[model samples]
Target: MPSPDPKIISGNANQPLAQAISRRMSMHRGVKVGLVDARVEVFNDQEIFVEVFENVRGEDMFIVQSTSNPANDNLMELLIISDALRRSSASRITAVIPYFGYARQDRRTKARTPISAKLVANLIANSGIERVLTMDLHAAQIQGFFDIPVDNLYASPIFALDLMHHFQGQMDDVMIVSPDVGGVARARELAQRIKAPLSIVDKRREKAGEVAEMTVIGDVTGKKCIIVDDICDTAGTLCKAAEVLIDAGASEVHAYITHGVLSGPAVDRITKSKLKSLVITDTIEPTQAVKDCANIRIVPTAPMFTQAILNIWNGTSVSSLFDTQTLEPIYEPLYPGLAIDA
Candidate 1:
C-alpha cells in the first residue's frame, strides 16, 4: 500500500500563521492541499473537545499551534489535538509551537516554585507527539526537558537581514545592546553579523515583574543601538534599557525581539519609550493595541517556517536555513518537483 501524504493541521492559538503555512505548503509540489478540518469546542462547563474531519491514519501529521495569550486554553487545545491524532493512528505527530508559553518558568526562583516548563514538556511527551519544532525558546535548556527530538529555530537571521536594510551603509554607527546580562550572547551574534560593537545593560531586578535599575556597560555615545532579546512581556525591561542607553548619549535606539508576548501595558510602555522604533516577529499574533502602536513593526515568519518544515520532512538540518548571511536555504527541497514558494 502507498504511504499517506503528509498532513498539516492547526489549533485556535494562531489561525493566521497556520493559514500562511498551509497556503505555502499547498503551493509546494504543485499539489492542492489545505488545513485539516479540526474543530475545537468549549462547552458551558469549560470542558474542551476536538474534532478531526479528515482521516489521519498512517499519515505524517504536523500541528501548528502556539501557546500564547490565554496560555492554559491554548496549551490544553494543543494537547487535545495531539491526543486525537494519536488515537487516529497517525504515523507521526510533530508539534509546531511558534511561541512557547510558560518557557520563562523553566527554573525555580524560590524553593517552593514549580518548574512549569518541565511540567509542560512532560505533558506534551505524554500527548503522543514524536517531535517538536519551535522558535526562540526563552531558555535553551528547556529542550533538555523533553525526551523527544526538539528543533529550536532562531530569529536572529531574520533580524540580521532586516538590519542590513534598516541601516544600509552605516555599519560604523550601529551597535547591538542586550537589555539584560543574560541576553549578551544573543545580542553579540547579531552585532558580529552586522559588524558592529556590542553592549549590555546590567540590570538588577528586585523581584519578579519589577526591574529596579539598569546601567549600560559599554559606551553608547553617538551611535545607533539595537537591543536584542527573546521575550518581551510588559516591555518594562526594553523601555528602561532604551532610556538608559539614551541617557548614556546614544544617538538612537531600536529593538528586535523574537517573541513579542506583549501582555498588559506593553503597547503603552513602548509608545512612551525613548526608542526610535521596535521590531518584533510574528511568532505571536499582534493584539489590537500592538497594531495601534506607530513605533512598532512586525516581521513575518511565514517564509522561515515554510522552509523549516520542508527541511524537517526531508530529514535535513533546519538550522542551516538562517545561518547564512543571505539568509538563504542551505538544502534544497528533497521531494520531487516540490518548489520553495515562500
Candidate 2:
C-alpha cells in the first residue's frame, strides 16, 4: 500500500510557508494535513530546544525550515527538530529548506577557511534527515555534499510565469542580464524559457560583499533589461549593475531574484536605485521593509513546493512538475487570490 499522507512540521524559520504548504496539501488530498503540534524555544543562554507533541511513530515527516537570517538559530532548530522526531520513532524525516544559508560558502577562496556549505550538508545528513528539499541552491555542486537524497527545486518556472504575465506581448523588447559572469547560467535559463536574448555583467569583486567595476558583455541598448541572480544581499551589486545597464542605454531595468536576502542597507539601496522594479520569491520570508517597498514585489513558491512534496511522498517523478516542452509548471491551479505578502 502507498504510504500515509506525510506529517508537516516546521521550525520558526518560515512558518507561513509551512502553513501554506499544509493548506495546499489538504486541498490536494481532500483531507486536512494540519501542521504537527511542535514547539521550538530558545532559552536565556540562547540554547535551542524542540519538542514534538504529536505521536509521529512510523509516520513520514517533513520539516520546513529556512536557514535565513539568524542562520545559526534556525539551523539549530532544524537539527534539533530532526533529532526529536528520530527519537520519537518517525519513519522518515525530510528537511524542507527553502533558503539554504551559508550556501555561498561552497568553496574556500582563501587559506584555512571552511567550506561551510559542505559542512552544513554534513550536519543535515547526519542529523537523522534522510532527505533534503530546497530551492535554487546557490551552488548546484552542494547537492553532492549530501549522502542522502537531495531535491533542489527551481524557481525558474515561477519567475517565468510572472515574466510572461508582466512582459506579455513585449517579450521581444526584453533582455535578461546576469549581474555577474557566474550568474549567466541562471539568467540564460530564464532567457531561454522566455525566448529573450541574454547579456552578462562581468564584475570584479574587490572584496567580500563589494563589487568594484563591471562591464556589460552584450548589447542592452534600448532593451528592457531584467537582471537575474540567486541572492540579493546588501543590494550593492544589483544597484551598481542597474546603473551600468541604464548608462549603457537600456530603456529600463527590472530584477527577478530567487532569494531576497535584503540585509544591511539592501532595502535602502534598492529604494534609491536606478532599477524600475525588483521581484523576488518567498523562499525567504519578507520583512516589513520588503513589504513596504513600492518597487519590490513578492511571488509565492508554496504551490510549487506543495506539488514537489506530494510527488516525493507518492514515489513519482518530481521533475514532471515542470513540462520540458513548454517550461510551465504542471500542477493543479493554486487557490484563487493567494495573498502575495504575509
Candidate 3:
C-alpha cells in the first residue's frame, strides 16, 4: 500500500511557485495539494490581517511562502497560516520558503547589531512550523538558528545540468569564478562538476552593496568566466567583478547566482555591465525590470525541487539528487545522523 499524501498549502507570497510544486506532486500516485485562500489586508494603522480558508484537520500540511518583497507582511502571513493549521488539528506543518528573508542579517558585523536571521528562525519555530524547506540560504549557518528540521537545497546540480546541456564542448575554455572568497565552496563545487578550472574575485566592500576594489585570484586571462554565488541583491559586487575580470584579460564573463533579489538599481547595473549573461533560479519572483533586462536568463528549478519533495515524501534518499560528478561535501553536517531516507 502507498503512503498517504501530504496536504500542501500556500499563502500569497509566491502562488505561482507553490502551484508549480503542487502540479509536480500531483503527477505521482496518491499525492495532491490544495491552496488556502490566505488573503491579507492592512488596516489604516498598518496592522496585518490574515485569513485561512481551508480545512487542515489531521493532515500533514506544507505551507509554501517566500518572504521576498514586503518581507514582514509575507512573514506574518506564513506565521498566521501555520498557526491556523496547528489549531485545525493538522498532524504536521512544514514551511516551504523558496527565498527566506532576513538571511543576510545572519551575524552581527558591528556591536549591538541584531542577529535578525536567528530572530526570524525563532519566529518561524514559535509560529508552530515543524520543518523548513528553503534554497541556497545566504549563510548556511542560519540553519542552526531554527529549532525545527531545516532542508537547505542546492541549485548547483540544476545549474550544472543546464551548463552541460548548453555549453558542453566549451567546458575546456570555461572557468568557474567565485565573486568572493566566501563563495569559494559553492564555486568549487560547480567547477569540479563541469571539470573547469576555478577562479576567485577578491572584492573589497567599503560599505554595504558597494564594491571598492577587486583582484583576480586565479588565471582568468583568456578564459570564459562564469561567476557563481548564492545571492545577487544589488548586483554591485557582480558587476564590479565582471569589469575587473574583463580588465584582467578574460575573454567573456557570465554569472549564475541562485537567488535573484534584484533590488534597487540591480537590473540597470547588470544591463550595463560587461557580463555576457546572468543566469538565476526562480527562487524569487522577478520584476518587469528584471525580466526586461537583456542579459538575464532564468533556469527553472521546479524539476529539482519537485524531485526533492517527492523523495522526502516517499522515504527515499535525497543525497543522490545532489551528487554530481561524485564530489565531496562542502557543508559541515547541518543535521548529523539524520538520514534522508528516513
Top lDDT prediction, candidate number: 2
lDDT of 2 by residue, 92-140 (tens): 9999999999999999988999999999999999999999999999999
- lDDT of each model, Cα atoms only? 0.86, 0.88, 0.80
Error of 1 at 246 (Å): 0.8
C-alpha-based local distance difference test score of model 1:
0.86
Q: Sort by TM-score, best first.
A: 2, 1, 3
Please give, for residues 172-239, the per-residue lDDT of candidate 1 as tens digits.
89989998888888888888776789999999989877888888998899999999999988998899
Model 1 alpha-carbon drift over 4 Å, by segment? 1-5, 329-342
Quote the lDDT for 11 in model 3.
74
> Model 3 over residues 91-151: C-alpha lDDT tens digits?
7888889899999999999999999999999999998889888888898899899888888
Clashes of each: 0, 0, 0
Question: What range of 10 consecutive residues in model 3 has the weakest lDDT sum?
Answer: 326-335
TM-score of 3: 0.90
The model with the greatest TM-score is 2
Off by over 4 Å in 2: 1-3, 324-342
